[model samples]
Target: MSDSVFVGIDVSSQTLEVASSSELKTWQVANDAAGLDALVSRLLELGPALTVLEATGGYEFEAACALQAAGLAVAVVNPRTARDFARAMGALAKTDALDAKMLAAFARVLHQHPERERFVKPLADAELQRLQALVLRRRQLVQMITSERQRMRISHVAARPSIERVIEFLKTELGDSEADVAAHVQRHHAELAAALASVPGIGAASVAVLLAELPELGRLDRRRVAALVGVAPLNRDSGQMRGQRSIWGGRADVRRTLYMATLTAVRHNPILKTHYERLLAAGKRKKVALVACMRKLLTMLNAIAKNGSKWDPSLHNA
Candidate 1:
């Protein structure tokens, strides 16, 4: 057994393919404890230097947790990135063995350091997960209700009593879920939540999104937190194109929440509002000014979290 082998596993609903040192192994086991244990033992024997895996929803989370518990270095990369690489390498035809091989080779060539995966820590409290789940479920239910209502309005026949009953139930569920989120926020993040809520234009829903999505907001530095939320302006330039700065990928939920918050901040938050107005006076586009406000708000939130203080207009002006 090599002391530093690189192992890659292609995980699916009912089975997994393991590859290491250019050798492939297949396993057909239930997505349960026993199956995961067997796979872990086999990989441990190889003493892998790193394990590269892809997100398979909740199915692979347990296996990844098991591997981590056994003191293995594991990193889960975006599945789309992995699949794109597979296609690039001409492994376009999908199969468990082929994916495993592609993943192994991907690991060998890309060699992503495990540190990249260390950023998102698992939720330690069951309550945090429950709160997040409720919030997500509520959002899903709201979208469903909206679509149903649109359908009902368009086709009178579709406005059946059954549809109304489901809509009513969804409304009740959303209310209950929202209440749960509020209670969780008060219990776990009282001061931070209050500080966020006190800001003009920010509301309970946006605060909940921030608490749930950007868990590292308070822990990280201002610039780092802004970038994490995808509000940090990034330069776009090529030899001569020299495009304007723009925001890019990060937590979508945080970015969505910030978008609304930024609109409000430009209108109310004294410092941000003045800065936004100045940009408008300088002939900046409204959208451009608004995005700048979003970055400013994120930076301010990080500072507020770090300092354990509320938003102070005077200090902001200084």
Candidate 2:
């Protein structure tokens, strides 16, 4: 195989299917420590340019980390992206082996298009991963508590106690999760956390979401950061027919969290409030102006993150 060979790995809880784009060779190994070691050994021997794996709900975590630790360019992509690429290639058959091949092909595409490689940044370190789990579980508990509160209105007295008990447990767990998230941020990302918290609307909740989910926040440029959080508008146009350009397809959690923060900022943040009012005066709908404020607030946050500067009203646009 050539030195620039691309590899695709379809990871599962049980096995890892490794495919090589150079010769289309496929092999299987157990998805354990030894198997990952052997897989990394093989990749190091081949000196592949880039390795692609689909994120199979944390199943890909071990192998991707092992490969990345071995200094391989490992990209853990969304499974649906690989599947859609397979369909485009006229391969509708579903198999772990075929999925590996598809991922290998996609890896080759990414290898050629270096600019798009931002989607496949390296895996989070252990500390950040733990924080992410805590934040995500807290969000789940919040959802469950909302459901339980709704059910209390219609539930019988006997049923209400059981529901209330669960709600209490969930709230306790949520509090613990939030504490863990804050401790982690303070321990590892203290500077970033302080910078983000300097903004009026970004409290612990918003900072937790940004720190846990968007680790690449400070490293990317403003435009790239906006797009990463799914706030950058996308175009849909065809010959003399222009469709609305709207943001879509990125980190939903980050975007949703930022939307909440922006809602608060537009009301209280001096720079954001003025900018929001300008858009409103320019005949923008309330929701439209709000979204614009959200994007603006996001860019300002990105700038602060990028430069390690505290939030400053005079520097909002700069």
Candidate 3:
């Protein structure tokens, strides 16, 4: 395997570049079926051990999928990590070609394997993705509507009728999207969805987000699920300074929805409520108490998903 060359591909909307241990190849091609075929062919000629690409929105996903289908080992890494590696290598100046070379070099030096995180794919649920996106847009529109309403109270509303119509249309579209998700969930992940909704605060929206983005929750251990959602805190300590652990860097949508749900859970779910009160009585700040509730909620969700059971309050009591 060591004798086999590793290939790094830097993919963009307008160009593609392939680099191996011994040589670099660049191709100017659109990101389409034709370009994808050409790149796969060239990669086949190299017979590289693995191919690496950075996650550029959804720009590289289709191409990566094509390569994977062709029986090539492909990994798409977070672009931030790749860029940081580039800076650490002292290649500050940026160009697509250089980034491609740097990606290959970074892979060789770090031995970073293709992202082990697997998203359930072909996603078979483009409608779920669309529905999730609609929910996000609805949230944004609600914010806009709120802002506009406040503005109307104080001054003249700007294009109020137009904005109102847009909001109404979005709401209607979101309703259809919701129906699509419900239909899909019923057909496939019905049990998981039912188990998730059995929790006190997990609602249709929360369940939808989980199904669309973090469908792997059913397979992950408790702490791992929390960490992936960015609700798990990390130790903040150093040689001379120490700070409290804080949660950071994961899907903001999941984290935010879970935060609100956890708050409601801590208030209404007896098991979580007692736990929340205990933490608060121990002099923990409300924020810290809420985080603990969030962790507990995630643990319960994971347990339910793994065990295929409803939320058990008796077992969950702190």
TM-score of each: 0.83, 0.95, 0.85
Candidate 1 per-residue C-alpha lDDT over 236-307 given as tens digits, one digit per residue, 9 for 90 to 100: 999979897888876787788899888877777778889999999999999888888888788777777777
Where does model 3 exceed 4 Å of error? 1-4, 24-29, 47-49, 108-162
Judge candidate 2 at residue 58 and give its lDDT: 91
lDDT of each: 0.76, 0.86, 0.75
Error of 2 at 145 (Å): 1.2
- lDDT of predicted model 2: 0.86
Best by lDDT: 2
lDDT of 3 by residue, 190-275 (tens): 88889999999888878877777676676887777787788888989999899888988766777888898997898788888988
Instruction: Per model, state how many residue pairs clash.
Output: 0, 0, 0
Q: Pick the candidate with the highest TM-score.
A: 2
- For candidate 2, write residues 1-318 as lDDT tens digits: 345789999888999999988765699999998998899888998888889988888989988888888898889887777888899999999998898999988998877874564466458898888888988988998899999999999998989889989899989988888888888889988998999999988999899889888888878887888887888888999999999988888889988998899889988898889998999999998888887888888888788888999988877755
Give the better candidate number (1 or 2) by lDDT. 2
Supply the global lDDT for candidate 1: 0.76
Model 2 stretches with alpha carbons more than 4 Å out: 1-3
Stretches of model 1 off by over 4 angstroms after superposition: 1-3, 21-29, 87-91, 105-125, 157-165
RMSD to the native, candidate 1? 3.4
